[model samples]
Target chain A: MIDIYEIIGLIAATLTTSAFVPQVYKAWKSKNTESLSLTMYLAFFVGIMLWLVYGIHLNSLAMILSNTATGFLALILIILKLKYK
Target chain B: MIDIYEIIGLIAATLTTSAFVPQVYKAWKSKNTESLSLTMYLAFFVGIMLWLVYGIHLNSLAMILSNTATGFLALILIILKLKYK
Candidate 1:
């Protein structure tokens, strides 16, 4: 049974996770990482990975799913940054 | 009492949240949003705000604190984007 709070968390998770979509897309399209911070992305990626692990421990589907996606997106950005630079 | 899991969550939360500090600082210092994706930040900000609310509902101190900070930082980035642009 999905709790109401989980629903809220799911919504929030979706928003935050999808938010990076455009960013990863844009960077890939234009190969422009001039405005994006590599350090920030790297740190964020690492953090998200940890969160994903934490989510798994907590049995949170939202956290696991969102962090997984965010982690992937951040990885793309990282690769894009390196490739473009 | 803070259990080991909470401690891990707290650490993960701190890392993920604070990860954006350098980013916000760099934008503020360089006044550069060129690399930063406005849409991403905007979406991320909204998401973080929702996460904060969700955290409050869950009674997770780490989530509340981290999301609060991330939300604020994202806001700073957003304002910098508009102002610099």
Candidate 2:
């Protein structure tokens, strides 16, 4: 059975990672990413990459899933920044 | 000796977590957080908490350090949101 901690983790992951959705939508709709920093996203991208590797090493599905989605979201922003900026 | 992957993880952690500095500075300087979302920050805070637990489990300094810092930064934003909004 799932514990309270796991439930909390799932909820947390769902919310935080899903938070990117609005930003992604905003960027996509406005097609303006002037305020978004590329350097920050790049760094975040790399960070997520490492987290993915770490998840793989640990065989943690939650980490892998969350980071993979987050990485993709960050990548979208990065691409948008490059394209629109 | 640390491997290449560890070095990359360190750099990623430093950059992404440190990226919060600019946002924090902007919020602090302007004393305006109208644009920041409270729900997002709250969600992020919880996510970081889980990541911290995960880091502890794996004894991964990089994960621990990055998430701890990010959690604090996210908390700041949450507080600022509550205070300003």
Candidate 3:
């Protein structure tokens, strides 16, 4: 059974994972990636990919799902950063 | 003994945690957060804080350390975003 900590983790994951949506929307809509750091997005993308791998190794559905979504969002921001730059 | 997946997870945690540094530096240096989404940072800050709590509850050193550092960094960015706005 899922406990309180797991529930907190799930909520944390949801918030952090979904947090990128507004960023993507803001950047895509504004067509502005000026304040965004290219290095951050690049590293974040790679990191999320690694976390996805780690999740797979651990057989964790939560990590896999969250990292996949976060990675995709970070990739979009990276592309947007480069394209909009 | 630590295994390969744990190593990968460590590296992933390091990368994602450190990734915020460049962003905080960029925003502080540029003093331009026009493109940075306030909602994103706000949600991310809260999310990371929650993750830190979850980590502590789980007694995971890795999650605790990484989330603590990442939370601090995210908080700085949030402050910078608001300050430089």
Q: Chain A only: TM-score of every candidate?
A: 0.93, 0.89, 0.87
Per-residue alpha-carbon lDDT of model 3 for B1-85, expressed as tens digits?
Answer: 8877777877888989988787678788889888678888888888888878876775655667788888888888888887878
The DockQ-based CAPRI class assigned to model 2 is acceptable
lDDT of 1: 0.84
* Model 1 steric clash total: 4
Report every candidate's CA lDDT. 0.84, 0.79, 0.82
**Per-residue error at A3 for model 3, in Å?**
2.4
- Runs in model 3 with CA error above 4 Å? A32-35, A81-85, B82-85
TM-score of each: 0.85, 0.86, 0.81
Error of 3 at A54 (Å): 2.4
lDDT of 3 at B58: 57
- Regions more than 4 Å wrong, model 2: A1-10, B1-8
Model 2 chain B worst lDDT window (10 residues): B3-12
TM-score order of candidates, top first: 2, 1, 3
lDDT per residue (tens digit) for residues B1-85 in model 1: 7877677778889888877788788889999788777877887888898888877886777788889888988998999999998
Model 3, residue A37: C-alpha shift (Å): 4.0
DockQ of every model listed? 0.65, 0.47, 0.69
lDDT minimum window of 10 residues, candidate 3 chain B = B54-63
Candidate 3, lDDT over the whole model = 0.82
Q: Cα lDDT of model 2 overall?
A: 0.79
- Give the candidate order by descending lDDT: 1, 3, 2
Instruction: Name the docking class for model 1.
Output: medium
